[model samples]
Target: MPIIRVTSLSEPGLEVYGSLTERQLKSFYDDLGGLFIAESPKVIKVALDAGYEPVSVLCEEKHIEGDAKDIIRRSGDIPVYIGERDLLASLTGYTLTRGVLCAMRRKPTVSIADVCRDAHRVAVINGVVDNTNIGAIFRSAAALGIDAVVVTSNSCDPLNRRSVRVSMGTVFLVPWTWSDDYQQELNALGFKTVAMALTDKSVAIDDERLKAENKLAIIMGTEGDGLPQYAIDAADYVARIPMSYNVDSLNVAAASAVAFWELRNR
Candidate 1:
Protein backbone atom coordinates (compact mmCIF):
# COMPACT_ATOMS: atom_id res chain seq x y z
CA MET A 1 0.00 0.00 0.00
CA PRO A 2 1.11 3.57 -0.66
CA ILE A 3 1.53 4.99 2.85
CA ILE A 4 2.14 8.66 2.06
CA ARG A 5 2.77 10.80 5.13
CA VAL A 6 1.02 14.09 4.43
CA THR A 7 3.34 17.04 4.91
CA SER A 8 0.85 19.87 4.37
CA LEU A 9 -2.94 20.34 4.33
CA SER A 10 -2.69 21.49 0.70
CA GLU A 11 -1.28 18.17 -0.41
CA PRO A 12 -2.50 17.14 -3.89
CA GLY A 13 -4.64 14.13 -2.96
CA LEU A 14 -6.03 15.58 0.29
CA GLU A 15 -8.91 17.48 -1.31
CA VAL A 16 -11.34 14.58 -1.28
CA TYR A 17 -11.53 14.52 2.52
CA GLY A 18 -12.31 18.22 3.22
CA SER A 19 -11.62 20.84 0.58
CA LEU A 20 -14.23 19.58 -1.88
CA THR A 21 -17.95 20.17 -1.52
CA GLU A 22 -20.27 17.16 -1.15
CA ARG A 23 -21.44 17.63 -4.74
CA GLN A 24 -17.88 17.75 -6.00
CA LEU A 25 -16.97 14.63 -4.06
CA LYS A 26 -20.09 12.98 -5.44
CA SER A 27 -19.47 13.88 -9.06
CA PHE A 28 -15.66 14.10 -8.71
CA TYR A 29 -15.58 15.69 -12.18
CA ASP A 30 -16.82 12.47 -13.72
CA ASP A 31 -19.97 10.92 -15.16
CA LEU A 32 -19.83 8.00 -12.71
CA GLY A 33 -21.87 9.74 -9.92
CA GLY A 34 -18.66 10.26 -7.83
CA LEU A 35 -17.26 9.21 -4.43
CA PHE A 36 -18.29 9.33 -0.75
CA ILE A 37 -16.16 9.57 2.38
CA ALA A 38 -16.79 6.78 4.87
CA GLU A 39 -15.71 8.02 8.32
CA SER A 40 -14.42 5.95 11.25
CA PRO A 41 -12.95 2.44 11.17
CA LYS A 42 -16.27 0.70 11.80
CA VAL A 43 -18.12 2.49 9.01
CA ILE A 44 -15.24 2.16 6.60
CA LYS A 45 -14.96 -1.53 7.33
CA VAL A 46 -18.67 -1.96 6.66
CA ALA A 47 -18.33 -0.17 3.33
CA LEU A 48 -15.40 -2.41 2.34
CA ASP A 49 -17.23 -5.52 3.46
CA ALA A 50 -20.19 -4.47 1.33
CA GLY A 51 -17.80 -4.42 -1.63
CA TYR A 52 -17.51 -0.66 -2.02
CA GLU A 53 -14.27 0.09 -3.86
CA PRO A 54 -11.91 2.19 -1.76
CA VAL A 55 -10.33 5.17 -3.54
CA SER A 56 -8.16 6.29 -0.61
CA VAL A 57 -7.88 6.38 3.16
CA LEU A 58 -7.09 9.33 5.49
CA CYS A 59 -6.24 8.52 9.08
CA GLU A 60 -4.39 9.82 12.12
CA GLU A 61 -0.75 8.74 12.63
CA LYS A 62 -1.53 7.22 16.04
CA HIS A 63 -4.17 4.95 14.52
CA ILE A 64 -1.73 3.69 11.88
CA GLU A 65 -0.84 0.95 14.38
CA GLY A 66 -4.19 0.93 16.16
CA ASP A 67 -7.67 1.63 14.68
CA ALA A 68 -6.51 2.12 11.10
CA LYS A 69 -4.07 -0.77 10.80
CA ASP A 70 -6.43 -3.38 9.43
CA ILE A 71 -8.14 -0.90 7.12
CA ILE A 72 -4.85 -0.23 5.41
CA ARG A 73 -4.21 -3.94 4.98
CA ARG A 74 -7.72 -4.76 3.82
CA SER A 75 -8.03 -1.81 1.43
CA GLY A 76 -5.37 -3.34 -0.79
CA ASP A 77 -2.65 -0.98 -2.12
CA ILE A 78 -4.78 2.18 -2.21
CA PRO A 79 -3.32 5.54 -1.16
CA VAL A 80 -3.23 5.83 2.63
CA TYR A 81 -2.85 9.43 3.78
CA ILE A 82 -1.40 9.61 7.32
CA GLY A 83 -1.11 12.76 9.42
CA GLU A 84 -0.87 13.98 13.01
CA ARG A 85 -4.02 14.57 15.02
CA ASP A 86 -3.75 18.37 14.94
CA LEU A 87 -3.01 18.44 11.22
CA LEU A 88 -5.79 16.01 10.45
CA ALA A 89 -8.17 18.29 12.37
CA SER A 90 -7.12 21.22 10.21
CA LEU A 91 -7.74 19.23 7.06
CA THR A 92 -11.43 18.92 7.84
CA GLY A 93 -11.63 22.47 9.33
CA TYR A 94 -12.54 20.90 12.68
CA THR A 95 -11.73 18.14 15.15
CA LEU A 96 -13.70 15.22 13.73
CA THR A 97 -14.59 12.07 15.61
CA ARG A 98 -13.18 8.53 15.10
CA GLY A 99 -9.74 9.49 13.70
CA VAL A 100 -10.15 7.82 10.32
CA LEU A 101 -11.97 8.37 6.99
CA CYS A 102 -12.08 6.46 3.76
CA ALA A 103 -13.06 7.94 0.38
CA MET A 104 -14.92 5.13 -1.36
CA ARG A 105 -16.17 5.09 -4.92
CA ARG A 106 -19.94 5.51 -5.02
CA LYS A 107 -21.03 2.64 -7.18
CA PRO A 108 -23.75 3.18 -9.74
CA THR A 109 -27.11 3.15 -8.00
CA VAL A 110 -29.68 0.51 -8.88
CA SER A 111 -33.10 1.41 -10.21
CA ILE A 112 -35.96 1.75 -7.72
CA ALA A 113 -37.40 -1.46 -9.13
CA ASP A 114 -34.12 -3.27 -8.65
CA VAL A 115 -33.78 -2.23 -5.01
CA CYS A 116 -37.40 -2.95 -4.12
CA ARG A 117 -37.76 -6.04 -6.27
CA ASP A 118 -38.15 -8.51 -3.42
CA ALA A 119 -38.88 -6.01 -0.65
CA HIS A 120 -41.99 -6.54 1.41
CA ARG A 121 -41.40 -3.39 3.47
CA VAL A 122 -39.79 -0.21 2.11
CA ALA A 123 -39.27 3.33 3.41
CA VAL A 124 -39.74 6.13 0.90
CA ILE A 125 -37.78 9.13 2.18
CA ASN A 126 -39.27 12.38 0.90
CA GLY A 127 -37.52 15.75 1.04
CA VAL A 128 -35.79 15.14 4.38
CA VAL A 129 -32.74 17.42 4.29
CA ASP A 130 -31.17 16.49 7.61
CA ASN A 131 -28.14 14.26 7.19
CA THR A 132 -28.41 12.99 10.76
CA ASN A 133 -32.09 12.14 10.33
CA ILE A 134 -31.41 10.34 7.08
CA GLY A 135 -28.74 8.26 8.77
CA ALA A 136 -30.84 7.55 11.84
CA ILE A 137 -33.77 6.39 9.72
CA PHE A 138 -31.51 3.97 7.84
CA ARG A 139 -30.16 2.56 11.11
CA SER A 140 -33.68 1.99 12.37
CA ALA A 141 -34.83 0.51 9.07
CA ALA A 142 -31.93 -1.94 9.09
CA ALA A 143 -32.48 -2.96 12.72
CA LEU A 144 -36.26 -3.21 12.48
CA GLY A 145 -36.36 -5.37 9.33
CA ILE A 146 -37.35 -2.90 6.62
CA ASP A 147 -36.59 -4.61 3.32
CA ALA A 148 -35.29 -1.57 1.41
CA VAL A 149 -35.10 2.23 1.32
CA VAL A 150 -36.07 4.62 -1.49
CA VAL A 151 -34.84 8.18 -1.06
CA THR A 152 -36.34 11.10 -2.93
CA SER A 153 -34.02 13.15 -5.08
CA ASN A 154 -34.66 16.12 -2.78
CA SER A 155 -33.72 14.18 0.35
CA CYS A 156 -30.33 14.44 1.97
CA ASP A 157 -27.62 12.14 0.67
CA PRO A 158 -27.60 9.04 2.88
CA LEU A 159 -23.94 8.45 2.05
CA ASN A 160 -22.80 11.90 3.12
CA ARG A 161 -19.84 11.59 5.51
CA ARG A 162 -21.64 12.57 8.71
CA SER A 163 -24.69 10.47 7.86
CA VAL A 164 -22.59 7.40 7.13
CA ARG A 165 -20.74 7.83 10.43
CA VAL A 166 -23.96 8.49 12.34
CA SER A 167 -25.47 5.34 10.88
CA MET A 168 -22.38 3.37 12.01
CA GLY A 169 -22.23 2.17 8.39
CA THR A 170 -25.69 0.61 8.43
CA VAL A 171 -26.33 2.69 5.30
CA PHE A 172 -24.26 0.15 3.41
CA LEU A 173 -26.13 -2.76 4.91
CA VAL A 174 -29.48 -1.58 3.52
CA PRO A 175 -30.35 -1.72 -0.17
CA TRP A 176 -31.37 1.75 -1.45
CA THR A 177 -31.65 4.16 -4.36
CA TRP A 178 -32.94 7.60 -5.35
CA SER A 179 -36.29 8.37 -6.96
CA ASP A 180 -37.73 11.39 -8.74
CA ASP A 181 -41.39 10.44 -8.64
CA TYR A 182 -41.34 7.90 -5.85
CA GLN A 183 -45.08 7.58 -5.31
CA GLN A 184 -45.57 6.68 -8.95
CA GLU A 185 -42.50 4.47 -8.91
CA LEU A 186 -43.56 2.54 -5.82
CA ASN A 187 -47.11 2.13 -7.08
CA ALA A 188 -45.85 0.99 -10.46
CA LEU A 189 -43.90 -1.72 -8.68
CA GLY A 190 -47.08 -2.86 -6.86
CA PHE A 191 -46.23 -1.40 -3.41
CA LYS A 192 -49.08 -0.15 -1.30
CA THR A 193 -48.04 3.41 -0.35
CA VAL A 194 -48.47 4.60 3.23
CA ALA A 195 -47.56 8.24 3.72
CA MET A 196 -46.74 9.30 7.29
CA ALA A 197 -48.55 12.59 7.60
CA LEU A 198 -50.86 14.59 9.90
CA THR A 199 -53.84 14.81 7.63
CA ASP A 200 -57.34 14.45 9.10
CA LYS A 201 -57.94 11.34 6.98
CA SER A 202 -54.78 9.62 8.18
CA VAL A 203 -54.89 6.25 9.92
CA ALA A 204 -52.87 5.17 12.96
CA ILE A 205 -49.52 3.65 12.03
CA ASP A 206 -50.41 0.34 13.67
CA ASP A 207 -53.73 0.02 11.88
CA GLU A 208 -54.18 -3.65 11.07
CA ARG A 209 -55.15 -2.68 7.52
CA LEU A 210 -51.66 -1.32 6.91
CA LYS A 211 -50.00 -4.52 8.11
CA ALA A 212 -52.28 -6.51 5.86
CA GLU A 213 -50.69 -5.13 2.70
CA ASN A 214 -48.44 -7.67 0.97
CA LYS A 215 -45.98 -4.93 -0.08
CA LEU A 216 -45.86 -1.73 1.96
CA ALA A 217 -43.99 1.46 1.15
CA ILE A 218 -43.84 3.71 4.23
CA ILE A 219 -43.33 7.26 2.95
CA MET A 220 -41.67 9.94 5.15
CA GLY A 221 -41.53 13.66 4.62
CA THR A 222 -39.03 16.45 5.27
CA GLU A 223 -37.82 17.78 8.66
CA GLY A 224 -40.04 20.91 8.95
CA ASP A 225 -42.99 20.93 6.54
CA GLY A 226 -43.50 17.14 6.50
CA LEU A 227 -44.50 15.39 3.31
CA PRO A 228 -45.84 17.57 0.50
CA GLN A 229 -49.55 17.56 -0.22
CA TYR A 230 -49.10 15.81 -3.54
CA ALA A 231 -47.07 13.05 -1.95
CA ILE A 232 -49.73 12.41 0.67
CA ASP A 233 -52.46 12.55 -1.97
CA ALA A 234 -50.73 9.91 -4.05
CA ALA A 235 -50.32 7.41 -1.23
CA ASP A 236 -52.78 4.57 -0.73
CA TYR A 237 -53.06 5.48 2.96
CA VAL A 238 -52.04 8.38 5.16
CA ALA A 239 -50.92 7.40 8.67
CA ARG A 240 -49.60 9.03 11.85
CA ILE A 241 -47.98 7.83 15.07
CA PRO A 242 -50.38 8.32 17.97
CA MET A 243 -48.50 10.65 20.35
CA SER A 244 -48.82 11.41 24.08
CA TYR A 245 -48.84 14.57 26.27
CA ASN A 246 -50.13 16.69 23.39
CA VAL A 247 -46.99 16.15 21.37
CA ASP A 248 -48.07 16.96 17.85
CA SER A 249 -45.59 14.75 16.05
CA LEU A 250 -42.19 13.14 16.37
CA ASN A 251 -39.11 14.05 14.43
CA VAL A 252 -38.98 12.28 11.10
CA ALA A 253 -36.12 10.10 12.37
CA ALA A 254 -37.92 9.02 15.58
CA ALA A 255 -41.21 8.55 13.76
CA SER A 256 -39.52 6.28 11.23
CA ALA A 257 -38.19 4.03 14.01
CA VAL A 258 -41.62 3.77 15.60
CA ALA A 259 -43.38 3.21 12.31
CA PHE A 260 -40.86 0.64 11.07
CA TRP A 261 -41.14 -1.34 14.29
CA GLU A 262 -44.91 -1.14 14.50
CA LEU A 263 -45.67 -1.85 10.85
CA ARG A 264 -42.79 -4.21 10.13
CA ASN A 265 -43.76 -7.31 8.13
CA ARG A 266 -44.75 -10.12 10.50
Candidate 2:
Protein backbone atom coordinates (compact mmCIF):
# COMPACT_ATOMS: atom_id res chain seq x y z
CA MET A 1 0.00 0.00 0.00
CA PRO A 2 3.00 2.32 0.15
CA ILE A 3 2.77 3.65 -3.41
CA ILE A 4 5.76 5.97 -3.88
CA ARG A 5 6.23 8.05 -7.03
CA VAL A 6 9.69 7.82 -8.63
CA THR A 7 10.60 11.47 -9.12
CA SER A 8 14.35 11.04 -9.63
CA LEU A 9 16.56 8.39 -11.21
CA SER A 10 18.62 8.22 -8.02
CA GLU A 11 15.59 7.83 -5.76
CA PRO A 12 16.10 5.52 -2.79
CA GLY A 13 14.73 1.96 -3.00
CA LEU A 14 14.93 2.04 -6.84
CA GLU A 15 18.44 0.62 -7.41
CA VAL A 16 17.31 -2.98 -7.60
CA TYR A 17 15.18 -2.13 -10.62
CA GLY A 18 17.80 -0.04 -12.46
CA SER A 19 21.26 0.41 -11.00
CA LEU A 20 22.29 -3.19 -10.42
CA THR A 21 23.59 -5.43 -13.21
CA GLU A 22 22.34 -9.02 -13.34
CA ARG A 23 25.70 -10.28 -11.98
CA GLN A 24 25.61 -7.66 -9.25
CA LEU A 25 22.04 -8.55 -8.35
CA LYS A 26 22.91 -12.24 -8.33
CA SER A 27 25.75 -11.65 -5.90
CA PHE A 28 23.64 -9.23 -3.85
CA TYR A 29 23.16 -11.76 -1.11
CA ASP A 30 25.61 -14.59 -1.70
CA ASP A 31 24.03 -17.96 -0.82
CA LEU A 32 20.87 -16.29 0.46
CA GLY A 33 19.65 -16.33 -3.16
CA GLY A 34 20.05 -13.14 -5.20
CA LEU A 35 17.39 -10.95 -6.80
CA PHE A 36 15.80 -11.01 -10.28
CA ILE A 37 13.31 -8.85 -12.18
CA ALA A 38 9.96 -10.18 -13.41
CA GLU A 39 8.54 -7.95 -16.11
CA SER A 40 4.92 -7.31 -17.13
CA PRO A 41 1.86 -8.02 -15.02
CA LYS A 42 1.26 -11.57 -16.23
CA VAL A 43 4.82 -12.79 -15.68
CA ILE A 44 5.00 -11.10 -12.31
CA LYS A 45 1.81 -12.84 -11.26
CA VAL A 46 3.22 -16.17 -12.42
CA ALA A 47 6.41 -15.69 -10.41
CA LEU A 48 4.39 -14.72 -7.36
CA ASP A 49 2.14 -17.73 -7.75
CA ALA A 50 5.28 -19.90 -7.85
CA GLY A 51 6.07 -18.60 -4.33
CA TYR A 52 8.90 -16.23 -5.33
CA GLU A 53 9.22 -13.41 -2.81
CA PRO A 54 8.54 -9.94 -4.15
CA VAL A 55 11.04 -7.30 -3.03
CA SER A 56 9.42 -4.29 -4.71
CA VAL A 57 7.45 -3.28 -7.78
CA LEU A 58 8.05 -0.61 -10.46
CA CYS A 59 5.11 0.33 -12.67
CA GLU A 60 3.93 3.19 -14.83
CA GLU A 61 1.48 5.53 -13.16
CA LYS A 62 -1.02 4.82 -15.93
CA HIS A 63 -1.18 1.19 -14.75
CA ILE A 64 -2.22 2.21 -11.24
CA GLU A 65 -5.75 1.06 -12.16
CA GLY A 66 -5.51 -0.12 -15.73
CA ASP A 67 -3.12 -3.09 -15.85
CA ALA A 68 -1.15 -3.46 -12.63
CA LYS A 69 -4.08 -3.09 -10.26
CA ASP A 70 -4.50 -6.74 -9.35
CA ILE A 71 -0.77 -7.35 -9.10
CA ILE A 72 -0.43 -4.41 -6.74
CA ARG A 73 -3.26 -5.68 -4.58
CA ARG A 74 -1.78 -9.16 -4.45
CA SER A 75 1.70 -7.90 -3.58
CA GLY A 76 0.36 -6.49 -0.31
CA ASP A 77 2.60 -4.03 1.59
CA ILE A 78 5.67 -4.02 -0.68
CA PRO A 79 6.89 -0.58 -1.74
CA VAL A 80 5.36 0.22 -5.13
CA TYR A 81 7.30 2.74 -7.25
CA ILE A 82 5.21 4.61 -9.82
CA GLY A 83 6.60 6.81 -12.59
CA GLU A 84 5.77 8.16 -16.05
CA ARG A 85 6.77 5.96 -18.97
CA ASP A 86 9.54 8.28 -20.13
CA LEU A 87 11.14 8.70 -16.70
CA LEU A 88 10.81 5.02 -15.96
CA ALA A 89 12.42 4.05 -19.26
CA SER A 90 15.33 6.36 -18.51
CA LEU A 91 15.88 4.60 -15.20
CA THR A 92 15.78 1.05 -16.54
CA GLY A 93 17.42 1.82 -19.94
CA TYR A 94 14.58 0.16 -21.92
CA THR A 95 10.82 0.24 -22.25
CA LEU A 96 9.05 -2.43 -20.22
CA THR A 97 6.86 -4.64 -22.41
CA ARG A 98 3.76 -4.25 -20.24
CA GLY A 99 4.53 -1.19 -18.11
CA VAL A 100 5.54 -3.11 -15.00
CA LEU A 101 8.53 -4.88 -13.41
CA CYS A 102 8.85 -6.50 -10.02
CA ALA A 103 12.11 -7.36 -8.26
CA MET A 104 11.86 -10.78 -6.63
CA ARG A 105 14.15 -12.60 -4.21
CA ARG A 106 15.52 -15.88 -5.57
CA LYS A 107 14.94 -19.06 -3.60
CA PRO A 108 17.83 -21.36 -2.79
CA THR A 109 18.72 -23.63 -5.70
CA VAL A 110 18.11 -27.32 -4.99
CA SER A 111 20.31 -30.30 -5.74
CA ILE A 112 20.09 -32.42 -8.92
CA ALA A 113 18.96 -35.34 -6.76
CA ASP A 114 16.05 -33.32 -5.41
CA VAL A 115 15.13 -32.13 -8.91
CA CYS A 116 14.99 -35.63 -10.45
CA ARG A 117 13.43 -37.26 -7.41
CA ASP A 118 10.24 -38.27 -9.24
CA ALA A 119 11.08 -37.18 -12.78
CA HIS A 120 10.94 -39.63 -15.64
CA ARG A 121 12.01 -37.10 -18.27
CA VAL A 122 14.58 -34.37 -17.64
CA ALA A 123 16.46 -31.81 -19.78
CA VAL A 124 20.01 -30.81 -18.94
CA ILE A 125 21.91 -27.87 -20.42
CA ASN A 126 25.70 -27.85 -20.48
CA GLY A 127 27.65 -24.64 -21.22
CA VAL A 128 24.78 -23.09 -23.23
CA VAL A 129 25.26 -19.41 -22.49
CA ASP A 130 22.65 -17.91 -24.79
CA ASN A 131 19.97 -16.35 -22.60
CA THR A 132 17.34 -16.39 -25.34
CA ASN A 133 17.96 -20.01 -26.30
CA ILE A 134 18.05 -21.03 -22.65
CA GLY A 135 14.69 -19.35 -22.12
CA ALA A 136 13.18 -20.95 -25.21
CA ILE A 137 14.36 -24.40 -24.12
CA PHE A 138 12.81 -23.95 -20.69
CA ARG A 139 9.52 -22.98 -22.34
CA SER A 140 9.60 -26.13 -24.44
CA ALA A 141 10.60 -28.35 -21.53
CA ALA A 142 7.72 -27.14 -19.40
CA ALA A 143 5.13 -27.43 -22.16
CA LEU A 144 6.34 -30.68 -23.73
CA GLY A 145 5.94 -32.93 -20.68
CA ILE A 146 9.57 -32.78 -19.51
CA ASP A 147 9.30 -33.12 -15.75
CA ALA A 148 12.44 -31.25 -14.65
CA VAL A 149 15.44 -29.23 -15.86
CA VAL A 150 19.00 -29.49 -14.62
CA VAL A 151 21.59 -26.99 -15.87
CA THR A 152 25.33 -27.32 -15.50
CA SER A 153 26.99 -24.57 -13.52
CA ASN A 154 28.58 -23.23 -16.70
CA SER A 155 25.19 -22.73 -18.35
CA CYS A 156 23.36 -19.42 -18.39
CA ASP A 157 21.17 -18.57 -15.44
CA PRO A 158 17.49 -19.22 -16.17
CA LEU A 159 16.58 -16.41 -13.79
CA ASN A 160 18.43 -13.81 -15.90
CA ARG A 161 16.05 -10.95 -16.71
CA ARG A 162 16.12 -11.52 -20.46
CA SER A 163 15.74 -15.27 -19.99
CA VAL A 164 12.82 -14.77 -17.61
CA ARG A 165 11.06 -12.39 -20.03
CA VAL A 166 11.71 -14.48 -23.16
CA SER A 167 10.37 -17.59 -21.43
CA MET A 168 6.96 -15.88 -20.91
CA GLY A 169 7.56 -16.70 -17.23
CA THR A 170 7.46 -20.44 -17.78
CA VAL A 171 10.96 -20.61 -16.25
CA PHE A 172 9.24 -20.66 -12.89
CA LEU A 173 6.84 -23.38 -14.00
CA VAL A 174 9.52 -26.12 -14.17
CA PRO A 175 11.84 -27.20 -11.38
CA TRP A 176 15.57 -26.59 -12.09
CA THR A 177 18.94 -26.40 -10.40
CA TRP A 178 22.64 -25.83 -11.07
CA SER A 179 25.11 -28.71 -11.02
CA ASP A 180 28.72 -29.36 -11.93
CA ASP A 181 28.68 -33.14 -12.03
CA TYR A 182 25.34 -33.69 -13.71
CA GLN A 183 26.38 -36.81 -15.64
CA GLN A 184 27.76 -38.61 -12.62
CA GLU A 185 24.83 -37.66 -10.42
CA LEU A 186 22.22 -38.59 -12.99
CA ASN A 187 23.86 -41.94 -13.74
CA ALA A 188 23.83 -42.86 -10.08
CA LEU A 189 20.10 -42.16 -9.97
CA GLY A 190 19.45 -44.82 -12.66
CA PHE A 191 18.92 -42.32 -15.50
CA LYS A 192 20.12 -43.23 -18.96
CA THR A 193 21.93 -40.18 -20.34
CA VAL A 194 21.43 -39.15 -23.96
CA ALA A 195 23.85 -36.59 -25.35
CA MET A 196 22.49 -34.86 -28.44
CA ALA A 197 25.59 -34.94 -30.61
CA LEU A 198 26.75 -36.05 -34.07
CA THR A 199 29.42 -38.57 -33.20
CA ASP A 200 29.92 -41.67 -35.31
CA LYS A 201 28.33 -43.77 -32.58
CA SER A 202 25.29 -41.52 -32.31
CA VAL A 203 21.87 -43.13 -32.46
CA ALA A 204 18.75 -41.63 -33.97
CA ILE A 205 16.46 -39.89 -31.47
CA ASP A 206 13.75 -42.50 -32.04
CA ASP A 207 16.02 -45.45 -31.18
CA GLU A 208 13.66 -47.82 -29.36
CA ARG A 209 16.06 -48.45 -26.50
CA LEU A 210 15.96 -44.71 -25.59
CA LYS A 211 12.16 -44.58 -25.20
CA ALA A 212 12.27 -47.80 -23.18
CA GLU A 213 14.23 -46.23 -20.32
CA ASN A 214 11.99 -45.19 -17.44
CA LYS A 215 14.30 -42.35 -16.40
CA LEU A 216 16.19 -40.24 -18.93
CA ALA A 217 18.43 -37.18 -18.93
CA ILE A 218 18.68 -35.46 -22.32
CA ILE A 219 21.79 -33.27 -22.37
CA MET A 220 22.39 -30.30 -24.67
CA GLY A 221 25.60 -28.40 -25.13
CA THR A 222 26.86 -24.93 -26.11
CA GLU A 223 25.80 -23.01 -29.22
CA GLY A 224 29.09 -22.72 -31.09
CA ASP A 225 30.38 -26.25 -30.49
CA GLY A 226 27.81 -28.89 -29.69
CA LEU A 227 28.58 -31.17 -26.79
CA PRO A 228 32.18 -31.48 -25.68
CA GLN A 229 33.97 -34.75 -26.31
CA TYR A 230 33.97 -35.48 -22.61
CA ALA A 231 30.21 -34.96 -22.21
CA ILE A 232 29.46 -37.23 -25.16
CA ASP A 233 31.85 -39.81 -23.76
CA ALA A 234 30.18 -39.67 -20.38
CA ALA A 235 26.70 -40.13 -21.77
CA ASP A 236 25.12 -43.57 -21.75
CA TYR A 237 23.91 -42.93 -25.29
CA VAL A 238 25.04 -40.43 -27.89
CA ALA A 239 22.05 -39.47 -30.06
CA ARG A 240 21.18 -36.97 -32.78
CA ILE A 241 17.84 -35.63 -33.98
CA PRO A 242 17.38 -36.63 -37.60
CA MET A 243 17.96 -33.72 -40.00
CA SER A 244 17.36 -33.32 -43.75
CA TYR A 245 19.06 -31.41 -46.61
CA ASN A 246 22.42 -32.06 -44.96
CA VAL A 247 21.54 -29.43 -42.34
CA ASP A 248 23.24 -31.68 -39.75
CA SER A 249 22.00 -29.73 -36.71
CA LEU A 250 19.29 -27.57 -35.20
CA ASN A 251 19.78 -24.67 -32.88
CA VAL A 252 20.07 -25.98 -29.33
CA ALA A 253 16.63 -24.69 -28.45
CA ALA A 254 15.02 -26.27 -31.51
CA ALA A 255 16.88 -29.54 -30.98
CA SER A 256 15.67 -29.59 -27.37
CA ALA A 257 12.00 -29.44 -28.41
CA VAL A 258 12.48 -32.26 -30.90
CA ALA A 259 14.35 -34.31 -28.33
CA PHE A 260 11.84 -33.67 -25.53
CA TRP A 261 8.89 -34.73 -27.67
CA GLU A 262 10.53 -37.74 -29.35
CA LEU A 263 12.10 -39.00 -26.13
CA ARG A 264 9.16 -38.13 -23.90
CA ASN A 265 8.04 -41.01 -21.64
CA ARG A 266 4.64 -42.39 -22.53
Give per-model CA RMSD: 1.0, 0.9
Quote model 2's TM-score. 0.98
lDDT per model vs. reference: 0.90, 0.92
Candidate 1 per-residue lDDT over residues 153-248, each given as its tens digit = 898999998789888899999999998777788888899999999989999988999999999999999989999999989889999998889999
**Candidate 1 stretches greater than 4 Å from native:** none
| Model 2: per-residue Cα lDDT over 232-251, one tens digit each | 99999999988889997999
TM-score of each: 0.97, 0.98
Which RMSD does model 2 reach against the true structure?
Answer: 0.9
lDDT of 2: 0.92
The residue pairs found clashing in candidate 1 are 26-34
